[model samples]
Target: MVIPILMEGKSKYLSSLLVIILLAASSLAVHAQEKPRIFVSTDIGGTDPDDFQSMIHLLMYADRFKIEGLVSTSFQTGRKQNILDMIDLYEKDLPKLKKHSKGFPDPASLRNICKQGAIAWAPYKGFRKSTEGSEWLISCAKKSVTQPLWVLVWGGIEDVAQALHDAPEIKKNIRVYWVGGPNKKWGVNAYDYIAENHPDLWMIECNASYRGWFMESESPKDITAEAYYPNYIKGRGEMGKDFIHYYKGHIKMGDTPSLAYLMHGDPEDPQGQSWGGSFTPITRSSKTIFNRNSTVADTVATYGVIEWRFNGPKINVPSDSTVFTLSIGGQHWPGYYISEGTYAVRYSPKQIEVGEYVTISSITELNGQKGTYVSKAPWPGKPEPNDFKLEQHWYGDKPDQELFLGQQQGAKTVSKHRKAFLMDWAKRWEWLE
Candidate 1:
């Protein structure tokens, strides 16, 4: 009788243990499913070396989200090999990372998803021939998942723009976070295409908000850009060693705010406070420069998209495929051949209160033709909708909003969360050690 009683007690204990184990496993599966799906389009090896720093930071935090793709955008200098090289370093450090976090993705999986994007910026219509990178982005967005794919564009938005051009339906399945300031200036044509065509798509055009990553006010000395590296990241691990190679090791991860947006807070609400800066819906406006030359009296709003149209000698080049060059403020900008002899180029002025002269020397009839225009403060009035006008989209804080540290337009929204995010990153850096 005593032996039977003991056996029954042991059976009950085993059943309770099994139920606890099963419950724990179920909890973990749910957590994994809740991770945001991410696709990154970066110009890692392009003119800016800061991309390398952002890539390293991304790899270290890979386990936090479902990393769907890594597409390199700059064909002139950046390549998929640049991303693969970082994966190699991650592979070397995988063992140590795995010791701390089981969710670290396999290096092989990451390499497989790394693809080369557009070899050049988009033509006049916003998309050229689709590349392997754009196709991969489409495939990821078309997946049957319930969550929207979060596209973090670290460099040119050409691929995302092209992917949308090819598969407009995918817009419903993806959300875009673009680090557009100088990047916007470079890829203005592609940016304009999406703004005009896909106004309803959910996107955060973070022009100056991303600047908050490195630029902060009243932050602790240890967490400042110069001090944080030596204090938390220097001599820590393989990632730490590789990080110093970019931007002289000072933290200029302008692209990192995209990741921070997903890391903490509700990504669904761009207006809500998060480690990434808050944003407001953008009011749309534009200016058109017609066939004639402009005098200094003609003015455009700073950051407002401007369309330059020139009626010149007709060439036999393919429609929407031909490229022309416009020299404005000593910078060469690409112009596209529209129907017939008309050529168009879209530009956004970055400087205010400065005179910009536009000249196109590529076309014979358009040669020696010069126009002068001055950029004033950004337009404050509500947009008057027109066929050529930009549609509504989300952007950094408005020009008139109160800011922290008197930072740039939307910078304070991001700078306000600096301490919380930096400290969180510090904890992750310790894992490398």
Candidate 2:
């Protein structure tokens, strides 16, 4: 009887222990599965061949992302078919890619996710009608998931604009990383609408360095036709050949940085160096409000505990009737109104939480003014500075005017991190290990 009692007690204890272990593992698995959920809208098989090149890099690392949608957006159209062609090649090489690492979604699964978007914009408009692309984006963005959907706009942002127009609420569910520059030129109207209306949406405008993926900047050796692609990517496999074939046996992977940015571990911190080159916040300009400019000067990188000081010409207004506060999405900084001309701003509630977006607003009934401001990450308590001094990031030896726009030179300036990635990527194609 004593032995039986002891055995029963031990069994119960082991069962509880097993349950705890399993639950712990289950939580880890959930966490491991939490790659950034991504939706890609590309204008491949269109005006530029770079989208196809970007698709190659994206498909090679498909296992790393929760790819929710492959959209064929505006340009010369036929984007969906191009995506299918790439997936078809991926199917042939699926086994090798899986052997390298697990979680390569079945080719058919990727195919199922591919959908058609608007073939043509509604003649000089941001978004006129919804297509399969817009609806699918809405579904993915609104999924009852904790993370926001990362929409990568490799070409025209028509689908995203259309989705926002159709379901304005989905903006809360999505973050955008657009290769703006030339793409912006194409979709200026849409870009303008999204910028003016969706002030709260987190965005990175890579017009500055996206060109660095293949052009100049941080690392150009990675994509040079003679030095890199021919030797590394050209003869590796069907996919390598496809990457080469996309642009006449060379490489044009300018769009890959957007996807690369997501793969660099911390998708939440855009300020960090990742697969995508680093970017900064868009300056307070009449044209750009929601976007982050890529140039060094126009960006807000990082800083410690400090107070922001703003000064403008004092205008005639009610003295006590005025309220000065930084407001955003219902959250406001408890402004300590200094005077009519100058306002000193600090993190609200004593500690400014990282990734918080707020708007600096001065309102006095008849007159009003506002601008967006994001708090820097937390810092150890340091002696407070007299006032907040805004600083611009310097991109290597780039010039002042060139630094802020980060256009051609700016993109190239930040290519170092990505060049290393391509070097490994080429080797991976050869080894598949």
Candidate 3:
């Protein structure tokens, strides 16, 4: 009788333990489902090596977000293989990372989603043709998931622009965080295309806010960009060791702030406090229209959209498609055909205080037209708040504003939060051990 009584108690205790295990697993599954869906378009391994550093940091935090796609849009020389190589390094450190994080995705899965984007910059129309990277982005954005697809543009905006040109409906499902200062200069045409066409699309254009990631921080020396790598990152794991290879072991991950913005606080409110810094709404963009070719005496606002209209020989073709190439400042741009003999092209000036020569050439009558134009600073004045019924696009505050750190516009907003984010990142680095 005593043995039977003991057996009955043991059985009940085992049943309770099983129930606890099942409940714990269910909680983990729910947490995984709740993670935000993210897609990354980077120009890694192209002009600067800093992208490599950003990629490494992103892999370490893979467990925190649902990484949907990784695309390389290196207009200079970056390729998809660059991302693949970094993933191989992450695989080596996966065991340790998994021990600390619950949802570290399989390395194979990440490789499967890696894709090559545009190898060259977009033409005048802001997009040339779709590449594998753009196609993958479109597919990921089309997913029926409940969460909005977060597009983190770390490099050129060519792929993002192309995807939007192909499928404008996806605009409703994506949120963009673009590190767009120097990158904007490189992909001005693509930037202009999106800003003009998708004015209502949700975006956080971190022109200067991303500068805060590596700016002066009040954190301890051991965690600062200069000392943190040697103290907490170097020799910790394969990912840590690979990180030192770029920027001589110093952190200049200007692009990481996009990820940081999503890391803490409510991302829905751009003006609110977060690790990624805050931004104000961009109510308007400068646009100038001309019916004839421009001359050197004509000046346009820097980064402002420029549109030229021309009447050429009538031809039947797809409207809004690349029908002619506009050469300006020695670069070829795409021009589109409207109904009748009208041809149009849109361009954004990337340089200030310099005159750029322009020329138009095509097989049609719209050939051999020549002109020049000078790009000046942005038009002076405060832009009114966005009144668009759709989503608002955010940009850094003006330079004279108190939000700026140094000469870079809209930098201080990000620099102020440097310490908090660096400290949090330090804790994640410890997981590599």
Once fitted onto the true fold, the runs of candidate 2 whose alpha carbons sit more than 4 angstroms away are 1-33, 122-125, 216-223, 283-409
Instruction: State the weakest 10-residue window (summed lDDT) of model 3.
Output: 380-389
The order of the candidates by lDDT, greatest first, is 1, 3, 2
Find the 10 residues in a row with the least total lDDT in model 1.
379-388
Candidate 1 C-alpha lDDT tens digits along 123-218:
778888899999999999999988899999998889988899999999889989998877877888888788778877788877667777888577
- Better structure of 1 and 3 per lDDT: 1
Question: What's the lDDT for candidate 2?
Answer: 0.63
The lDDT values for all models are 0.80, 0.63, 0.79
Question: What's the residue-level lDDT of 190 in candidate 1?
Answer: 87
- In candidate 1, stretches whose alpha carbon ends up further than 4 angstroms from where it belongs are 1-33, 283-291, 321-323, 351-355, 377-396, 404-407
Best by TM-score: 1
lDDT computed for candidate 3: 0.79
Clashes of 1: 0
Better by TM-score, candidate 3 or 1: 1
